[model samples]
Target: MKLHGYFRSSAAYRVRIALNLKGVPYEHATVHLLKGEHRTEAWRARHPQGRVPALETDEGAFLIQSPAILEWIEERWPRPPLLPEDALERARVRAVCAIVACDIHPLNNLATLGWLKERLGADQAAVDAWYAHWITEGFAAIERLLAPGPYAFGETPGMADLHIVPQVFNARRFSVPLEAFPRIRAVDEACAAHPAFAAAAPENQPDAA
Candidate 1:
């Protein structure tokens, strides 16, 4: 399997964590988002939206969208499950993951930021402010929903924990203040220390150019 992704992309980061947690060995294909490689005709043919994390499965199927890719991973390899067995618990975890992926992440994606700069003439300071604002708001809700212990759900770093960690990584990159979100910070720190999470980090990726 080949995973097409940018090292710094949060969406790709989630997939990386999922792959590592599942102990899936796959070759990394670097798509340099900063260089606008994702928008190229070749990449667009594979992924209509020209996004990172278009996973070519071992069976030769292309899976796009981080959430869909994550669900696919969990379903294909059920051992050490990333989701809960109960439907209600699964829904709760999915809710938290969706909040970050659908609502907060889309608003802060590269295309959205670029549109703000190119179309709206948003200055660097304003753009940075916009990014941090969403991070703060998102973290506030996440902190509330998170359990008091290290990981978001409990001892294991499940789906919600995986999604939360990457968003916090982005939050720190954009200089969002995190002191207010102690619970969120605790869970992030714990996950960062785990081998799977550590190995899948952006800086640790081989193609972090």
Candidate 2:
């Protein structure tokens, strides 16, 4: 399996964490998003949407979108489960994941930020504010939903942890004040200590600037 991704991409970062936690060995294909590599013809042929973290599965299948890829990872390797066994618990965990995946990340990803500056004629300060606002709002909700533990959903580093840790990494990059979200901070800190999450960090990736 080969995972095509960029070091600083939050979407790719989540997938890397999941693969590592499952102890799945795979190759990494660096997509330099900053250099517009994802927009090139080659990348477009490989991924129609031209997004990072496009996983070439062991069966020669290509997977896109972090959420679907995450679900596939959990299903393929069920040992160290990334989700809870109970149906109710699984729904709860999925909701927390959506808070980051659906609500927060889409608003603050590289494309949207670039659009704010280039297309909309917004300055750096305005872009920074845009990033911080969504992060703060979404984090407040996540902080409330999080379990009181080392990880997002109790002691294990599951699906929720995979999504939370990467988004927090992005938040810190934007200098978003996290003092208001202690539970989210605690989860970030705890996941940092875990080998899987630590290895999957953006800076730890080979393509990191």
Candidate 3:
């Protein structure tokens, strides 16, 4: 498998965590988003959306969308399962993942930030304020939804936890305060202690350059 990703992309970070947790061996193909490589025709051929973190399988399958790619990884390698077997448990986990993936992430993605700058004439401070506001609102809800444990759902880390870890990492990069969300902070801390999360961190990537 080959993963085309940018080191700082939160979506790419999520997929990296999922792959590492599943113990999958994949070659890295760094697509520097800052250099506009993701927008190039060569990269666009793999994912028309021109997004980072597209996975190309040995069977010649290419996957776009971080959520879909993660689900595929979960299905292919189920040992340290990310989703629970029970339907209700899975729903709960999905809800948590959605809070970050759909609600928070989309609003603060690089494209959106660029739009705010170019279209709205927003400065860096304004863009950062926009980012923090959404993250604060989203994380407050996530804190309420979390069970008082190491992970989001329960005692063990699961799909929701994987998504949460990267979202929090992004939040920190933007200087968002974690003080108001104790449960979310705890979950992120717990995840950071795990090898899977540690190994998948952006700073640990060989091509973080």
Candidate 4:
């Protein structure tokens, strides 16, 4: 498998963690978002949306979107399962993933931030405030939703942890105060110590600047 991703992309980071946790070997192809590589025709051919994470499977299937790609990985390789065997527990884990992927991440992604500045004429302060506001609000709900644990859902790292760890990394990068979200912080710390998550970190990526 080959993964086309940017080093700092949170969406890409989530997929990387999932692949690593599942013990799947994949080749990395860097798509430098900051350099506008994702916008080129070459990338558009892989993903119509020109997103950073477009995974080409060993069988030659192309997959896009982090959530969809992760689900595919889980289905294809279920050894170190990323979801619970119970239906309700699986739903709970997916809910937490949605909170980060759907509610929070979309708002603060580079495209959205760029739109706020270029299209709406928002200043740097306004953009930064927008980023923090969404993170704070979304994380508040996530903090309450999370069960007390070293990981988000339970003793083992699951889908929720994959999503949460990357968002926490992004949160700290923006200097968003995490004092109110102790549960999130704990999960992040636990994930950092896990070899799979550690290897998938942005700083550890081959394309990291």
Per lDDT, the best of the predicted structures is 4
Candidates in order: C-alpha RMSD to true structure: 0.8, 0.9, 1.0, 0.7
> Taking the tens digit of each residue's C-alpha lDDT, what string does model 4 give over 110-207?
88999999999999999999999999999999999998698998899989999999999999999999999989999999999999999999999999
User: Which runs of model 3 end up more than 4 angstroms from their true locations?
Assistant: none
What 10-residue stretch in candidate 4 is worst by lDDT?
43-52
TM-score of each: 0.98, 0.98, 0.97, 0.98
Error of 3 at 47 (Å): 0.8
Q: How many residue pairs clash in each candidate?
A: 0, 0, 0, 0
lDDT of each: 0.91, 0.91, 0.89, 0.93
When sorted by lDDT, best at the front, the candidate numbers are 4, 2, 1, 3
- Give the per-residue lDDT of model 2 (tens digit) for 1-209: 99999989999999999999999988899999989999999999988887787999989999999999999998999979999999998998999999999999999988888999999999999999999999999999989998778889897989999999989999998899999998999999999999998898988888778
In model 2, which residue pairs have backbone atoms overlapping below 3 Å? none
| Residue pair clashes in candidate 4 | none
Q: Give the runs in model 1 whose Cα sits over 4 Å from its true position.
A: none
